[model samples]
Target: MKKKIINGFLQILGIMIVGAIIGYSVGKIAGDSLSKVDTPNIILLLIAGVVVFILQVIIHEAGHLVFGLLSGYKFISFRVFDFKIIKDENGKLKIRYERLAGTGGQCLMRAPEYVEGKFKYRLYLLGGVIFNIIFSIVSWLILPSYYTLLFALIGFVLAFLNLIPMGFNDGMTFYHASKDETTRFILHLQLEYIYYQSIGKNLLIEKPEIVEKINSLEITNTNYLTDALEFIKLDGLEYFFEFDALYNESRKLYIERDDLLPVYKVELMALLVKLISLVNPEDELLEELMNDKSLKVRLKQNNPQTKNILATYENGVKLDDEKALNLINEARKIKNKAPNLYIQNLEMKYCDYLENNIIK
Candidate 1:
């Protein structure tokens, strides 16, 4: 809490300094001309500018806090000037707030992990923007022309700018959280294509039982295929092949169509071998897979698909052990080299699995 207060004070102080610099420069440039008119009025404008800047920070963050609470998020802590402190009740930390510098200013609302469902997630993310827009609109109507116009501009900028559908922005997070079906489909198709390419060359390793297992299982729809492919991509061929083999043996049911499988068992075996290489940098399989013509063809064709698949994987899965252990292990090995692609899935999977299998 003390830290938050101090940080808030620093932020306000920084804004004031910047405001002062701008005011001083403007005053120097037009001070003589303005002196001929009204000294007091000019001073008022200067104060207004500084106050507006500071107020902007407060209102912006307040917008986030207001909407966050409305959307059912708990407040952590708030800072005004120059103090930092934390409040805890029964070991549950009180609300916390962090100032987001870019994207028209933002505050992260850390909700409890138990808060699941898309509505809650969406509300939490969009809360600040919504409140900012509302405040801006109201300020424009009520405030005098000078301040009204400024507030309106700030509001418009925050709303539209934050809505850009890209990394770390609200729009991207919202879109992924919403689980737009088209996005999911494209992602699924792309991942399967990548896996197909990765394994196209190693047909010689005859794992008949595994082949027979995957073939027997009923992978009826594109969705299931996508899920299966994602599992393989994250888990690596070793775990996937075992799972597939087990699934096949358990189901012993035929899929309605051959095209449903996308590739044959021999092809899958080769693909797994190729994938095994990429799983770990030090693994021997990389060289052999790299040289294989069929694998190269599939990889080239599937690169785009892989990217989409990765995005979809991120959107749907929240890191858990049973879901993507291989990805987690690889990421752990590489430190910062790990891609954010499957981290969420790995965390959720591990946590859930451990909770159920080990903790329980």
Candidate 2:
């Protein structure tokens, strides 16, 4: 309670300080003998401001994309507001229209493992802010129009704000990721697997170092990294039952931190476990998870077909060949991206096996 009050006071104090500075800057600029513009010109200036602001956001995300791809990371998805572009199973980019909670835009990339790759991801993390700073400086130099000046101001503020290490922002993740070798190493390997999967490669993969670290179990308490490693290790394991134990373990970890956890992220991971582990999740359990008002709402909004498929998977044992095939067709026919493509493909593969069709 005391800490909250202190933090709140500090936030207000900082806002007031910034406001004063901005007011002073405006007064100084206005007093410098600037000519008054006509109403039409003013309207054009406002439109330019809006256009430049949007353009800057695109430039910011592009920074991350450029740095990430150059740093041995593969692009997974790029989202701007409700529009997302994700790589499909055939390694083709597919656009999905969806909205994420409390986020404006993001570029997701998967990092590959390299033993000597230290501080490499820092560029990917700070790419947006770095680009923002450079762009602002260039804009100030090249175009000193009022709209451009406003753009530079917003750009500088955005760059600096992204540096504050809080929430799910790049700064906090970068700070945590850069310091933790075990977690970072595991993530690299996991991403490497996804890269291979993107090109239709899947195999049982193991890393002794990762296994040893997981077994030791004496890491930071309730870390997302731990949850990630716990679940990520299950990838590409052929035996369905092998995934069951880890699924439970990871699910427990996720449940403990459910409130703070990103729902779709963890649930998508859970879907992977359920499908790859080849366990037909208990009907009650499936209902409990998918029926959870929060997840249900998201699923319905993002991919109603996926929500149907999950419910279908829970009752898979009862569905005959035609029915199972129909479900797979329905999911695949959906224009938007599946919530968990890996899971969807796995389920479809399982259904095909029942249908006695050769899977390519």
Best by TM-score: 2
C-alpha root-mean-square deviation, each candidate: 18.2, 5.7
Which tens-of-lDDT digit does each residue in 305-342 have in candidate 2?
45344434534534344565565566556534443355
Summarize candidate 1's per-residue lDDT along 1-360 as a digit string, tens digits.
Answer: 586568657756755675566446544654454455433466666677666655665666676677767766555434433221222323343332222223334443434323123235556666656766787667755643544545555555555545554434666556654565433333333333332322231111233343443444444334322334433433343333353443333222222322222233324433444233223334443456456675454443222223222222322233333343343333334322111223323333433432343223
State how far residue 90 of model 2 sits from its true place (Å).
7.3
Whole-model lDDT for model 2 versus the true structure? 0.59
Model 1 per-residue lDDT at 327: 38
Candidate 2: give its CA RMSD in angstroms: 5.7
**Model 1: runs farther than 4 Å from truth?**
1-50, 77-106, 112-119, 180-360
What TM-score, computed on C-alpha atoms, does each candidate reach?
0.34, 0.68
Worst 10 residues of 1 by lDDT: 335-344
Question: How well does candidate 1 match the true structure, expressed as C-alpha RMSD?
Answer: 18.2
The number of clashing residue pairs in each candidate reads 35, 0
